[model samples]
Target chain A: MIEVKDLRFVYPNGVEALRGVSLKIEDGEFVAIMGQNGAGKTTLVKHFNGLLKPTKGDVYVDGVNTKDVSVATLARKVGYVFQNPDHQLFCESVEQEVAFALKNFGFDQETIEKRVSWALQLLGLTQYRQVSPFMLSGGERKRVALASVLAWDPKVVILDEPTIGQDYAQKEKLRQFIMQLRTQKKTVVIVTHDVEFVAECQPRIILMKNGKIVADGSAKEILTNPEVLLQASVIPPQITQTFHYLKDIGLPTNVIDVYEARETILEFLGETKK
Target chain B: MRFMVARESVEVIKTEKLTFTYAGRNEPSIRDVGLSIEKGEFVILTGPSGCGKTTLCRCFNGLIPHFYQGKLEGEVIVAGLKVNEHPTYELACHVGLVFQNPENQLFALSVEKDVAFGLENLGLPREEIRKRVDWAMKVAGVYELKDRAPYELSGGQQQRVAIASVLAMRPEVIVLDEPTSFLDPLGAKRIFEDIYKLNQKLGITVILVEHRLDLAAKYATRVIVMNDGRVLLDGDPREVLSLEKTRLLGVGIPKATRLYQLLKNDGIPLKSGKVPLTPEEAAEAIKEAFKSD
Candidate 1:
């Protein structure tokens, strides 16, 4: 579980990114934090892994105050995947890249290899195990970065903008990976602007603006409310917009994901949806 | 080849059998790409990452031969000037390139200084630079943040500053390569609106490279789809987006178009011949198709 109590953080340049924010996440819960640029989403999540300590208030991860733990110590409990994969990748090969963190946490050689292989296979990077990550495409690099973090199997995983530059098929695979993490009983927190992906994942939504939490609720509630999302520059997922269009046809109006939208449309056309 | 033509031409930019291979790389970034842009056209170029969209943009502003070390083949003419012959500084007067990352483009401490950097580099006088800087800042909607440092602003604000910096040059053509990659959809929509306004109000040639087809496809008069260093599809937004090959190439079809596809697959007829690119258009089309209900 993660607990943030009245968290506030001011950068050295006097930018107040987080202003008196408070939140809590139970174990194994998936939460998607949605907001516009510079809405304090990244700043708030950095507190989870001790990357940024709160200026005022406290953050407790697994009952331990983040203030008292070093970033390296918190790595065992929390894994953060930055928005840009290039920012964090440094290893020569994809295999070595995934093994770095596991080795750092003092895992034995056998365990490290097993975890690295499993992670690489899970993210479909097995074929490029010996290749340098620098030569990979943007989507492949993102998967490598994600595999590296997942290799360690940190109790809590946080991803920032996991869907940027990803194609439709790639996004579907990423959704499967997010679900896999939940099956492992790991806490998943995603910071992103891809409302469609958010609707597909269907996690708890947290919308922020100007260093404050504006709304928190189910994906159906927050995403369907297009006006609130538009205020922060987040458009609802495509299916929800389609459902809104079909409201005049007496089709289902509350659909958020593609499957429901597809079913509703098929029914409206008098064809049973597959 | 007399690419640096003396005679006036209708095409502002043109490329014939253009192919470029990056230095120390085996394969070509762009392959046999034949393209042309008229004086005032808003073209959206989209493809998966590493599809050579950025490399093609570099060719227009002379960055391909000037800054990047690469072997170029074929002809590229911008404002009737050969890209290989003219210097980048000279091409800057005709074409301006705004990169994806704002931090990579912004160097001056203050936003005002950054916006004025291009004008000053052109040897413009102080008063003229000031006038152009103020005008560009106001147009890009970053006037209030002029005094703040570039690092102090948000991603969207910094992108606005980048756009203003390029606009201060007052080039005949502006090429933005995913200028809104860092912001949310709404923020990106706002930035796209600003660029659309610039295209409408000033008649500046705009070439925007982006992946968010849902938000951007509506603003474009033309769409160019690329994959594996080749143009896979190019036409009006509706025609290109409706192709089956486009979806197979992993291009992000606009959501409204997807909804249309779903309806078509369900044996529902569309009222209009063209696929709807926007939500409102989609709604209108859907209402017409199901009028009997």
Candidate 2:
């Protein structure tokens, strides 16, 4: 669904964010870009939706060069969610916020209303339809921002730090919602440092460090590699660390999630007793 | 061993029958809260999001009434001073607060200048400002980045500089409200380590309002859980974390703890108690279990 070739981006102030970054993401593939601050994760996502024009190289979305497409048209196929909810949410009501994008995309009022309702229902925000956007909590505001994008029915959804500042319950809810997006065959790209969330989601991991891709592999492969994780300033999920310890005790390091870690340890103990 | 006096010997803050409600909001943000902190205790306040942790922090720093228009009831005393009667600036000298967003708190061009801005406002002598700036930088482990611009540094570095700026004032209490929420995992660990060092080495009273239970579980001596503008649980970290209700409350246990819980349930003959907080400790427990088995 997305392809980049030798993509390089330099801000007007001479800060190089992306340096010859090239990769391909197929349709319906959920990719997670993990990095510390200033790793150009945000800069890389902007190019996919035409919010940023590459200083050098090219970004192709569905075989069409991003430079050749308008941001408005590209937005219909690619959606970007900023880190701060306050920056993206500007509509007075939740219903209007979700409908704003559809109306801008030239959908009629009736169609816009239907799509808005669908997006609200998908995000579990239907009951908040009449509430002021500002009156909602931080997590609710994030849902509104996501609903605004999902309402347009974009094929690719790129979220930057979607779980930041969210509590455990909110994080779980958002993770479930993202999983639902996978069922719809939408390619999902999440840029985050929440290692546990990344582990639970088990998406393909692309680790970025200092404007470069350090490691790209499955969540288990990338997270279990402590040296790479430490160098990238990323912490492995807690369960991964637990399994590493269990491995030191002659146990297998095959567990990825916490629940699996528990079951694996229990089975190991049973085998030892037998 | 030259045993210094215990931190509990010196009381720094006390609250009694404290209640606050934001204007036009029916529910009180903080209700009938009574808490106290010794001179150098490190406390972690945690709960679900929107459970009034921020409001409780603001009350301690006098932002509840002085800066925010709200109904303030009861008394909050900080460093022998009542917050309800004092201006925020006056209260700021004894209580320095590092907010959630580092971008929102920083205003100076260079790191050294930002650290010195607070001391300068207090009208300290030039020599004192220089000495305190150096001390704060060294304490926060940002002395190497003093010449760099705050914007040019990474998020972790910027947050350290924020701590340095607040440290230059030499406040009796330092409250960090989710300082690592905007940082990566490594950055979050560094910030927490710095807070731990400050509390242990400098004898600074530290109040951390955070949602990262794994990190907080390992660091804080006292854990206070808040929900619905009230204190849900208050005790040592081990006591609060071992509750079955913790999981039901939507606050997760550390990954190591969950693993240990599983091992115990499987009749692994491990000690039954609060789970270990660190990976190293968990490894030690596993080794011990293998030896006994």
TM-score of B-chain for each predicted structure, in order = 0.94, 0.93
What does the lDDT read for residue B229 in candidate 1?
90
Candidates in order, TM-scores: namely: 0.92, 0.94
Model 2: per-residue Cα lDDT at residue A131: 80
Model 2: residue A115 alpha-carbon error in angstroms:
4.0
Interface RMSD score of each model: 2.8, 1.8
Candidate 2, residues B1-293, lDDT tens digits: the string is: 79887645777888888899888677788888899889888998888877888888898889988887889998899999899888887888899999887888888989999999988887889999999999999999999999999998889999999999999988999999888878888889888988998998889999998777777678888999888888989998877876777766877667677667667666777755556876666666766666633
**Per-residue lDDT over B194-277 for candidate 1, one digit per residue giving the tens place of the 0 to 100 score:** 999999999899999887777888889999988889888888989999888888777778777877877777767677677888
Model 2 has how many clashing residue pairs? 0
The Cα local distance difference test for each model comes to: 0.87, 0.85
Error of model 1, residue A222, in angstroms: 0.8
Q: Score the docking of each candidate (DockQ).
A: 0.54, 0.67
TM-score of 1: 0.92
